[model samples]
Target: MWLLRPPGVYRPQPDTWLLVQALHDAGIPRGARVLDMCTGTGALAIAAAGVGAGHVTALDVSLRATLATRFNARVRGLPVRVERRDALTFRAARQFDVILANPPYVPSPQGDLPRSGPSRAWDAARDGRALLDPLCVNASGMLSSGGMLLIVHSAVCGVAPTVDLLHKVGLKAAVVARRTVPFGPVMNRRIPFLEEQGLITAGQRDEELVVIRGDRRDDQP
Candidate 1:
């Protein structure tokens, strides 16, 4: 089950792997419907199915990534539905019990991205929170009642602001888990930006993995 991953698509992050492990540890029941947003290479979705998710839907904006996911799932014999659509534009007819997303958290101005490859994964809007804010706002609608939304991003994205955005969207969010990994290609550029923004003051640049969960609630404004 090996296919060439798209260039801009971020490969699976260590934190994402940790989050999946956390979900398994928390006992995400077998046969539960799960959605993996911004799915790259179908890693999380495939892992979910392997761990007992009844069904898994993997969504990504890149056609190449989706195709890769489809091929990966087929090769592994994992039942996963891969969708090629913008995460912001795509909608699910039915809500999901478990939703996982590892979006583009790097802050980049429009048209700033490289022509293609891993660079696409690194281009988040200015302030790094641009994509994150919208994702939280729409997350409420995408989740089933009592459903959980799991997301991972860099600490340089400003953890406080990210939490604030989630709260603004009516999702009670928390940092359920975190992991620090050696800085890589994505972090190489992001680190300096974060420093200039005063997001990080001192310390070596280490990739931060944050897991935020939004729990569905009945009470609504």
Candidate 2:
């Protein structure tokens, strides 16, 4: 799919495509309400609409990202509502039947998240859970009964922690997909820091990206 990516907007990469494939595997119900969190180029949102979602909302903290998504969706004639908002604090009026996320999970030396710039696209805090932890805790509240959340992140941040967080919130979660890819420019540059943080071994040139699936039980209120 073609996209209009402004400067600083994240270019769709492996993690994005991995999440997209996982979203397709999840099988959207016709007319299901969907939310795409941290929608970089709105790839997932457009995909959700293309797959027959009744209402699709894409949220990103970056203005360029939101505009890029709006334009991308417009050109494709997809009815995707684009919003410039922080996913961690966003609350929709109605629960979504499906939520897709490819948030920033890269371990960064910065003690806190970057408030602005391209780094925001991929830099999470030291542990790489700056967004993941909260997303897991809050996702259950955003999902309707029987809804599912599909998110992608690197195993360097620890997949079990994410699964445990989802489980704590009552979502039946597990790693549904995995792909091993060589480090990109960003990860490759962070090799020294990553090794120091114990996120990677000294000679590890590849990282495994995992797609985690969390399903809200039908019995949930």
Best by lDDT: 2
lDDT of 1 by residue, 53-171 (tens): 99899998787789888988888888999988787677789888889888877765453433466656657766666567777888888887777888888787778887787788788
lDDT of 2 by residue, 1-221 (tens): 78889999999998899988988888889999999999989999999999999999999999999999999999999999999999878887889999999999999999899999899999999989999998999999999999999999999999999999999999999999999999999889989999999999989999999999999999987
List the candidate 2 regions with Cα displacement exceeding 4 Å. none
Candidate 1 regions with alpha-carbon error over 4 angstroms: 1-8, 109-117, 218-221
Number of clashing residue pairs in every model? 8, 0
Candidate 1: worst-modelled 10 consecutive residues by lDDT = 108-117
Give me the overall lDDT of model 2: 0.94
Q: What's the TM for model 2? A: 0.98
